[model samples]
Target: MTASDARRPVQLEIAVQDAAGARIAFEAGADRVELCQALAETGGLTPSAGAVEAVLAVAGRAERLAVLVRPRPGGYVYDADEIAVVAADVREVVRRGAGAVVVGALDAAGGIDTEALSRWIDAAAGAEVVFHRAIDTLSAPVDAIDQLVALGIRRVLTSGGATRSIDGLGTVEALVRGSAGRVQIMPGGGVRVEDVPAFVSSGADAVHLSARRSSGDTAPSGPGGGASGFDVTDGAIVAAARAALDEATSGS
Candidate 1:
């Protein structure tokens, strides 16, 4: 690593589904927050306009927040109409004070959708563009890093093509080395506080996690009797992760 890069502290990014989660993340000392909606149901999807406004209010700075632009919960392969919707959502979120937009799309061949990516970049109108975990779906994700860099993407959130970031540490390290400071490689997906040191030692620019805990009524009710309770960001988890990252990167 370059001398300057070695001195750069690792960032801690928390994924949140609402304003309240944003507040928790902020208070926990998060470097940035990725705001979304329906995280429990769909992993994450584009939040409503009001949701964006609320999160921005708590973030206090646009660059402290990034909003996911996924139009649906399903696969990243999008139809024309879905692409149009994504474009509109990107513009809307950016206009609403999102400093960065997390987005990804795949072609039928299971590769990055350059066309859709270009459209989203244009719609962002200067806001940072982040390529989400869709890169993990590729057979050779390391090779795709260069493609993303060429596309002017500022960052990429990934689990190194594995279900959990910890299990994919080797691949994550390769991705970090392969990026060569061109694009930020953030290890995400099932990342735990215990895993922070490993990722930090890998030279990752940042680490991302939902850090959520569930609450609410578990009594049988509603259509499927599914738990009526919901998940919220756990401040304790965020704070623990923050401490771990700081400890790991200390004197590096």
Candidate 2:
């Protein structure tokens, strides 16, 4: 960051929906926490106003908290009812004083829904707006960049529409370049400490991950239908992510 990059050390935000998870991201040195209810479902809107307040009350300044604003989980394209629901969710989330709101919408053709996005952005007037990974789902990555830039999104959290960020290097690289300085191109999903450099090299301002590998005692508490493949984000994973950023900074 050079101590003057505006946002230093390449912010490492973690996804934590519960208090226990909040503590993990906070103690492990995550810069921001994207609060949600169903982490396994790629997260939805914040569970409650009280939930957002609780996290802010105890989380550190480095640990900013944000709430997701999806009415329900499905494809990026939302029906009119879902859009209204998400708009309402945005207003509520902002009133609760979240650091940011993560939301996205796609057209029927899998492109950025500028109209729906504007509604979400308008409802979240004071909050930072993150165009969630729905961007990766777009039919055209380059075109999506233009749409997001035109919409003045605060950040675009994408994995290049691939299962993981690393796998979409080429698309991600193009996005970073096309975006230039219009919006922050944040490569997330399956982002690991080891691959942090590539993302940075691809010009990402930040990275996202659950940052947990094992659930430990929380193992039985799974979030999937099969009851297996639980997503476990832990302190160690966050620590490793931090280390990766350090290495990248040192240019090692």
* Top candidate when judged by TM-score against the true structure: 1
Q: How many residue pairs clash in each candidate?
A: 0, 3
Q: Estimated TM-score per prediction?
A: 0.95, 0.87
Model 2, span 165-184: residue lDDT tens:
89998888888789887888
Instruction: Report how far residue 92 has shifted in candidate 1, in Å.
Output: 0.5
The all-Cα superposition gives candidate 1 an RMSD in Å to the true structure of 1.9
Predictions in order: lDDT: 0.91, 0.77
What range of 10 consecutive residues in model 1 has the weakest lDDT sum?
A: 1-10
Q: Which regions of candidate 2 are displaced past 4 Å?
A: 1-8, 41-45, 60-63, 214-232
For residues 61-84, what per-residue lDDT tens digits would candidate 1 score against the true structure?
Answer: 999999999988988999999999
